[model samples]
Structure formats: structure tokens, C-alpha cells
Target chain A: MAMSSALQNGLIQLQLFEEYSWVFNLLFYVIFVVFIFYGQRIQMYVMLREVEGSLFKLKYIKDEGRKIAIETIKEIGKPQTDPAVRVDRFLEYFTIGPQSLDPAGVVWKLEHILDIRDVRFKDEVKLMAPATDDTQAHNLENTLEAAMALNFIYKIIRHFYLLGKKTLSLYIIMQIQMILPLIMREAEAYASALKAFAYGQPIGDGAGALVAAKLMRGHEIRKVPKDCVVATVPIEGRTTFVMKAEGPGGNVGKIGDAIKTVIDENEGKIATIIMIDAAMKLEGEEVGEVAEGVGAAIGGPGVDQFKIEESILKHHIPINAVIVREDIGDAVSPMRKEIFESADKAIERIKQLMLERTKEGDKVIIAGVGNSIGIGQ
Target chain B: MSKTQSNATTRISSFVLLIIFLTLALSLTALILATTFFGQGNEIIAGYLLLIGFIGVALSTYVLFQTRRRMLRLRIEIPPIVTTIECRKCGFKSVREFQRGDYIFKEGEPCQKCNEKMLITAIYREVKDKEKTA
Candidate 1:
């Protein structure tokens, strides 16, 4: 009786399958697709959670930002007791991509970028660090690298997201979706970077400080009331104050504080204030192209721009800007050969602009604005 | 900037080649499946295969259209690199396509007007925006 009933049930089931096979296939496809999508998504979040946890474990901070800078450097690549090697290693990692056609050209480019005048990078970094300690410099370099990693990851996400939204095409969306794994990898890098910054590691974005430090080499670096260091450098026979965030280990320092302090010390007797910085270029613009115009050439939070504007207006100083242009990728990622080369070109442009705008012996303030990480002052 | 032109061309041509290959393969696969289904005398399955072939054709056409539109937009998006040549002596200036081995301060061809060794005073990417008129 049981066998007969089982046979009858199998017959009925077969008849039903023939009737609803298409429905069954459709249902199976839907479930499979859903499983793939949700399963992959869950894995993505878990991966991110793991990275965040790892980054969080490597926390350290120094007076203001010393320890953070040291640990950040240690986590980024290798933490070494030798500060000089540590610093060198950290910078080498920033050039992580393809090699330049000419390494000499890259050095020439680095020189130009700093407008170093007579100062060597080694001396400058030594002066900029809290006390020329190699450990601090190493830490500083690490912090900057972390910041750059963050910038690269964020830019990638933003660039594709914007491209997809603007095009509003299914193909574009699908393409972005395909590269989500790649984006997630960049996100992991950013997590480590953010952890570094939170620990008070200085950012690589403090490029302005390095340039300023370069110009200030061979001069006495005096800490003003602000978080910045200032030095008097004569240019075209004019008294010019070059200021950068006193850095070796990492810091975008308090640029507004620096700007305000220097302007206050000058007593409204400034001829021209020229700001040189890295600017975001348009899609067609070439990396390292130099552009000159009026106003502040700073890139960051609005606070610095506001402070500079307020101080300049109060002092009745005519301010001008010279910028080295970079695309989104170049601006945030490790310094590329092209951008490094632009620094050389930017120096020439700045000299030309300063000469055209100010008379000899005119008191001027030239602020190289950016994170001064891995940069000596 | 000199690399922009070559990069765009390389990218577009490669993309075009890929689309052509895909379309050809898709068409061939669809034709083979449709013929086999028909040869098997399963008219219902043959009709379904034929329908799928038509859908493939429609998709290929849509993809081609989208690709062409993308190519045109990308062309407009990249600003042309304009090389500015200036004579150091006479200061006569002219613009041309950025040539290889050109740096901002490096000297290039002699000036047409002054016959002086002209400097590559500036190599900038300039956007020539055009307004669409109905």
C-alpha cells in the first residue's frame, strides 16, 4: 500500500513539474542571484570590520603628535630605531607606483618643488622636527604617508561615484559595481591612515610646510605664538618671512595661527603676501602646470583661508597666489614624478610673479601651504 | 598633456574592438543555437532561441549607441593641450600642440617671427567650451 501511494505521489509530482517547470526555473534563478549578491556584500563588510580593528590596535601619540607619528610610521611599513633610514624608507614607499623616466629629473623636480634656495632637505627636516630627532622625522614621514593613502582611497571612491551619478547610465553603474572590490582595498588603506591621523600623526598634506621649511633653511627658525615656525629669508633684496608648520613627524600645524601671528608681528607694513600651494586641476589640465592669480592658493578646511583673508585685509596687504596644479589622484596620492617636476616649474613662476608685483626691498610673506609631513623645516 | 590624445585614442579603439568581437561572438552563438533548436524539430524551443537571438541583436545595437555617445562625450571632456612658445628676445608668442621633450622652461623650435630660439614658456591644457544651440 505504501509503495503504491509513493508511486501515485511521484506521478502527481511529475505532472505538476511539467506544468510549472518554467516557474520553478524562474524561482531558482531569483534565489541564486539574491544569494550571490547578499553573500558577497556580507563578506565585504566583514573584511572592512577586520581592517578597522587592526588599524585601531596600532595606536600611539606623542606630545601633540609625536607618538602618533612614530607608531603610524611603524605600522605603515617598518618601524625602525634609526630615524634617518626610517624617514628614507617612508618616502620611498610614497613613490610606490611606476618609476620615473629620469631619477635625476625627479630630484631636480623635488628641488624645484621646495624652492629650497640653499637648504638641504636633511637639514630642513632636522630643524623642523621637535628637536632634530630621527625618530620624530620617521614618525612624521609615516603620518604623511597615511594621510596620502587616505586621500588616494577617498578620491577613488569619490571619482567613480561622481562619474556614475553624472552619467546616470546602467553600464557605468555596472562598471563601478565591478570595481567595488578594488575600492574596498583602498578603503582598508584609508582605515589605517585615519587611525594614524587620530593618533596625532601629521599628514602628508602639510606640503606647504615642507616648501616653507626649504625656503627657511640657513635661517633661524623661530616659533611664533602660533603652531608655525617662521624664518626671515631675503628675496630680490626684499625682507620676506617664510613660515611652515614646524614638522618632521607630521602636522598640518595651525596654519591660521601661523598666518595671524606673522601678520600681527609685521604691524601692517607688508607689501605683498604670496601663497604657493597645490591646486586641483580640471580634467584637461596637466599635472604640475603652474598658474598664477590673485588671492590665497591654499587647499584645506576653510579656516585657514578665512584667517588669511581676515589678516591680509586688516593689514591692507595685496595677496597673490601661485599654484602647482594636480589632478585628484596626484593631489592626494604619493607625490608622483610629474607633480615633483612641477615644483621646479612652480618656483620659476613664483619668482616671476613676485618680481612683477613687488618692488625691491618690499616686505613680503610667502607661505608654502600644505601638510609638512616627511618634510623638514 | 601630449599623452592625453594617444591615451584617449588607444582606450577608444580598444573598446571598439572589444565591442565588435563581442557582437560577432554573440551573433554566432545565437545563430548556432537557433539552428540547432530548429533542426531538433522542437518548434517551441526554436521560437524561444530565435527570440533570444533578436534580443541579443537589440542589446548589441543599444551598446553600440551608448559607446559612441560615450566616445563623443569623452572627446569633449579632455581639454586640448596648448603649447605656448615665446621668444626670449622679441617676446613674440604662438601656441601649438605640445610636442615630445617639451618642458616649461626648455627651448623648442626657433620663433617664426623673431628667428630666436623660442622657449616653451607655458604648456597648459585649455578647455574650449561650446554652448549647444537649438
Candidate 2:
């Protein structure tokens, strides 16, 4: 009778284990579904934030420039002719003037009176004017429609992201509610594993490092000592780099001079300069997604991109850019595996490129170009 | 600036004072009814009503004071004449005078002359000389 009781007890224990396993599997499936649904939505929010920030900045700049333009116009005073007559004469020029005289040039001349520079974008403005005798008749309904469509898409994506985040939070709460006791029992093991992952020595042949090296093909990679001045430039936007080499001057004109100095000083030691930056993503593109592109100069107002491009060209240096495409909505999330993978791939590619470019005594520059928010130099 | 206008202002203030007394009387009547229906004690309900009444009086008084002060400080001045250049390509033109928060040109408005969209080129307040006494 005692032997039969022992067998019954074993059977009950096995049944309990099976029941627990079934519950665990159910929870796992629910969490997986929540992650998939909300992940896309979170990405959309980040993109929106990015676009909004850029638009705000652009508007600020334009407003300031507009103020300056108005002041200049006021100082110059109106033409001697009657206001209506002057306007009439200006309109007459459009009909009778040299056909070769482009709309941009005409607008530029007008803006020149106001001492407004960079009137090249006047054509875009002109394209949106009304068809009244006093205004340009260009119908911009199509463009406005396109803009509205883009806004709608962004809103939909953001809605999804918020939904996903909420679902994830709920799932976590549910898990805690159901498995609080179990979690408490295994807390010690969980803590130790986390600690080991954080500070433990490289494991399993340094797979991460090997993956990074493979991605950085065609570039030379040399682990330089910390505090070494790899590359530096007085660029307009805030840039965070692993090793920033500070040079003289703040304006765009001095960019070439600074780059040349840095390159010359570290010639044999430094390999290629890898510039990682935030790039505006086209509509429908994923935020925080990384793309490898040939580095192009993107200087702000008064800082011409051509001048910087010319400088790099003059030095015959290959500038590779790993751009993080994001939108206006603080759309950057650390949890996105794709972003991390892309970043890793970029780093690996840069490493390989550096190794290929540099010889025995070369140095490499990896410049993380963006607003240094939540990212260390 | 004129004696006649100052007298007119005093008359308006007196009229407003009369209106406030009537509003207070009406509100007190309403509070009494509310207390009766809600089964609240006279002192407790009256205290609550008094608080609300005081706030209302304070807000109205502040608004009235501001309006009166502004009327007293009002200075009639001649408007400045301005010349503007309307863009032929886009109806975007330089307007001489615009009040704060006014849109000189809205987005996506087409130009009349060149069939281009109008973009605000300039916005400014016109400066004019005060009329001289003969």
C-alpha cells in the first residue's frame, strides 16, 4: 500500500509540471504577438518626431531669414513709382522680357533688392502661387495632396506603434501577475546571468567581433589607443565621434583647411574616415534603418555642401557614410534589432575598409554624425 | 485726449456698476434654491455659494478695470500708407502693414501672373510721420 501511494504521488507531480509548461507556452505566444503588432507602430512614431524636428528647425531658419529680408527691403525703400504701377511693371517683365531670363533669376533679382540670399528655392515658392492677375497661376493642389497623403500615412503608422507599445506593457503586466512567485524563486540566477553578460570576457571565439570585421570589407581596421585624435572638423551640426580631433575655426570655409591638416598629420597612421549620421528617410521607409552610402557633404545655411565636397575630393580621401534614417517622432528605439544589426554591419564594413586602406602605421577615423542625444562620443 | 470723452467713460463705468449689483442679486437667489433642492444646510451651502460669487465678482472686476484702462489710454493715430511689390510668378507680395498673427500668404495659393504658387516674400509694419498741425 505504501508503494502504491508513492506511485500516485509521482503521477501528480508529472501532471503539475505539464500544466505549468502549457501556461508558459501560452504566455510566450501572447508576448510574441504583442511584439510583432506594436514594433511597426513604435518605428512610425520615431520617424514622425524626426520629421517634425527638422521641419521646426527649417521654419525657424526661414523666419529669421525673412525678418532680415524685410529689414533690408524697408531700409532700401520702395521704388519711386506708385506702388500699383511698380507692381504692374514687374508683371510686364514676365511677359516681354528675355525668354531666357528664368523665373528663378527674376525672383533672385527681386530678393536681391531685399538683400535676401539663396533665392534659388524661389521657383518652388512660385509653383505654389494662385492664378490671380497679381499671383502666379501655378496649381499646387497636386503637391499639397501628396504632402497630405504622406501625413496620413505617418499618422496611421504612429497609431500602430502606440497600440503595440500598450499591448507590450499589458503583456508584461500579465506575466508578472501570473508568475511573480516563480520569478522571485529564480531571481538569483537571472541576476547572475545579466552580470556575466555585462562584464564577462569575450566568449566563443569573439563571434561579435568577427561579424563586425567581416562587414567592414575593403577598409583597414586597427585598434588605436584611446584619446588618439583620429579626425576633426568644425561642422555646423553637432557630431559625436569615437575620437574627435578638434581643429581651428568654426565656419564652413575653414572645413577644408581643418580636414587637410588632420589628414596630413595622421597620413600613414589613419585609414579612411567613416561618417555615421542621421539621414532623412523617404516616405514609406523604415525609421532607424541603416543604409551605406557614399558620404556627401550636408552643411547648413552659409555652409555650402559643394565646398566641403570639393575639399574631400581634393584630398582624394574616400568618405563612407553609414546613415541612420529616422523621422520626427523621437522614433529611435534601442529595442529594434534591425537598427542594431545595421549599425553592427556598418561598423564591420568600416573596419574591413580601414584594414584594406591602411598599411603598417595607419590610423582610422569613425565619426558618429548626429545630434548626440543618448549617444556617447 | 478730450474732456467730452472722459465724461462718456465715467457714464459707462457707472452703467457697468449698476449691472454688477443686479447680477449679484440674481445669483444669491439661485444659490438659495440650490441649497433647498440639494438638502444642504444654509451655512455650509451659503459658504460655497459665497466662494463662487466672490470669484465671479473678482474676474468681472478685473476685466472691467482692464477695458476701462485701455479706453482711457486709447490714442487715435493716422494709419501709415505702404507700397508693396506683388510677385508676377507667384501672387506672393510684400505687404506694408499686417497685424500680429495675420497670414500674409497661405500655403499652396497660386500666383496670378506666372502661374506659380504664392509664397510670402516680406511682411512689415509701415512707418508713417504724425500729421503736423497747421
Highest-TM-score candidate: 1
- Model 1 per-residue lDDT tens digits across residues A1-377: 99997678667756765887899699999989987878655554454443332222211111112333444445433533534444433333332222458664453354344333212434534433535344354444445455444444444545555564566444554555566655554443343343333333222243344356556766877886445778999877888888776554444555666777877877878888888787877766765677888987776535467678888888788988877776443443334445555656766776777788889988888888875543455
Candidate number of the best lDDT: 1
What interface Cα RMSD is found for model 2? 31.7
How would you encode candidate 2's per-residue C-alpha lDDT over A196-294 as one tens digit per residue? 111111111111221222233223323222212232322122121233211110001123233444555555233455655455566578644657666
Candidate 1 lDDT for residue A244:
74
- TM-score per candidate, chains pooled: 0.44, 0.26
Measured on C-alpha atoms, candidate 1 has an lDDT of 0.56
Poorly placed runs, candidate 2 (over 4 Å): A1-258, A267-271, A297-299, A302-304, A330-342, A356-360, B1-134
Instruction: For model 2, state the Cα shift of residue A195 in Å.
Output: 33
| Model 2 lDDT per residue over B1-134, tens place | 01112223223456676776666666666566556734543443455566666666666677577656645433212222222335645445654432222222223345566667554322222222341110
